[model samples]
Target: MLFLKSNKKEKHFFKKNSMSKKSYEEQAEVLSRAIDIAVEAFKKFRPKDFTDVHLAHFVSVYEGYKNDILNPNYKFRTLSALADAKNDILIYFQEGSGPDVNFFWKRIAEEKIGYQRVNKMAKILKRKRIANRMEMDFVTDCLVAYRQEGLISDEESIMLDKMIFDFQKKGK
Candidate 1:
């Protein structure tokens, strides 16, 4: 009697949890279609002043998912991650935006061209022994522009310029 009861419970568990490969593939197809619909709607209905940063990030995530969805050895985690990304994107699109754009969306060009990002790139180039004079010159120009715009401190600008100058002194 106990054996029969356990067998019945096992069958029920399997029935509830079992999903075939075809089922998962079909679900992936549905997710891709949904992403397409959301992309179109977002492009059509978003405000004119709203920049494409969020849209670009969302689309890039989708493109990565799409490219990997058809692999014969694909794992379930990829599908799960895509679904989570989709949910977060939909939440971003749907909530609180009926009133006004967020402060993040109002950021100027100087803010977007972040000081740390440029500094990090320059440091990486120098550390990797790939810091060409032209690239360092470009970095120096960007730092100067950033200083003029108040995006970076004068001291910070001087320090970065000094770093680039030192790198350039070695050779071209």
Candidate 2:
């Protein structure tokens, strides 16, 4: 019958699409892999022993997710990597004692960094904010903050300073 034929076709389509999402066990495996990747990156930073562990964990997780966050269609791998880093960091911070204890609340001075914030900064630059001293100062402060946070090297900071100065002087 025509009805039976349609049902058979529907079942075939369903089976083909059944593997789109992974199982819980598979998700766990992916997350575990992400944690390992994050830890390796963290070790490279060689954070100071007196550095705030919570901040370190947050920074590590941010570093792990940085590239992925820029993607509009964030893949499963990205989600898993972020989740993995957060989980491991949480566990590590929960220890709450030893040399890391007193270092817990202390934080390295740094300005806030976020995806939207970065985009806004770029937009601001594209604007004619260089007409005034305040705007120039704002950009300079941001560059300095970035340097302090190790996001930009001192040389890069100096270069940007000169570039901004040139832009302001040009008055365009």
Candidate 3:
């Protein structure tokens, strides 16, 4: 009778716990899928052109999640982090094609406003080996300031949100 009672209790406990036991492999698979979706969305939805400052914002977001989603023990931020990451990656890739391909930079130069400072900051970003949070934060701050100065457009902001969703779906 005791053996039968103990077996019943064990079965109940097992049933209760079974739903939560996600294997590491399963988690990794999910993360990979999430990244794929994000990458696709970035490729599809990103503007054909963007400014260096916009690209910096997109990169900051991506760097945040590239660390968070891959590690099993890492605390998850809200879905916004993922969006930020995707947008950042998209912008970064777009900017790498040079100034001729990016109209925003040309506009800045034509206007003769904030062009020199932006160029200087871009050089700093390129030269600095951003291996730590401090360097990353500095870049982010500069980018934010550029945005505040009306350098990046509302269309760019919308693209950032799209990239976040793309990353979140992929990271899932």
Candidate 4:
């Protein structure tokens, strides 16, 4: 009993004396930065709608940050940080930011088929789909990606050329 008590006292003494370790402020900063990186990784795909795929992507990115980006000592549920970031991702999903959906719809619109024809198609799809999440993703992505700069000229081709230009280029 005496020996066990001595060992417990020594363990407590070391734990209490180890006050020079990383501070709470530093841990919080690192966690915030890790979450930021995780979100950016998912953004690379430009998924307009949040689906099972986006959730998987977010989980992979979060794990990457937790295991590789953070110190090995940090252990917590990845969902903890994700709970906060999920709202931001949901906004993008609501805005219809996916890759191929919008472009396809706009192509059909720009072609011989007019908006009425497309609305008819949407109605048909609405009857088939309970929630039109995928359909909406397609329409919204097209509007923002194609129509944002200005109206699409009837003379222009319907082909979507996804130019891989860097908007965040260096140098002022």
RMSD of each: 12.8, 13.1, 17.0, 18.3
Error of 3 at 138 (Å): 32
Alpha-carbon TM-score of each model against the true structure:
0.35, 0.27, 0.28, 0.23
Per-model lDDT: 0.52, 0.46, 0.45, 0.42
The lowest-lDDT stretch of 10 consecutive residues in candidate 3 is 112-121
On TM-score, the leading prediction is: 1
Clashing pairs in 3: 34-170, 34-171, 35-170, 58-88, 59-88, 61-85, 62-85, 83-164
Candidate 2, 99: how far from true, in Å? Answer: 16
Candidate maximizing lDDT: 1
lDDT per residue for candidate 3 within 18-84, as digits (tens), equals 5433443344444444444334444344544646566555545554555565553433433344445
Q: Which stretches of candidate 4 lie over 4 Å from their true place?
A: 1-29, 32-47, 72-172
Model 1 earns a TM-score of: 0.35
Q: Which digits, one per residue and each the tens of the lDDT, describe model 1 over residues 3-56?
A: 555577788776755555556566566555544554555555664456789767
Mind sharing the TM-score for model 2? 0.27
Candidate 4's residue-wise lDDT over 1-172, tens digit each?
7455557779887776454233433444454553454355355444545687876876676665545424434443233444444334233333433443344334434543222223322342335422344544444455444455444433221212211111113211
Instruction: Give the Å shift of residue 2 in candidate 4.
Output: 39
* Regions of model 1 farther than 4 Å from truth: 1-19, 47-49, 70-73, 77-86, 93-172
Please give, for residues 126-168, the per-residue lDDT of candidate 2 as tens digits.
5634545655655665765456666556665565677687877
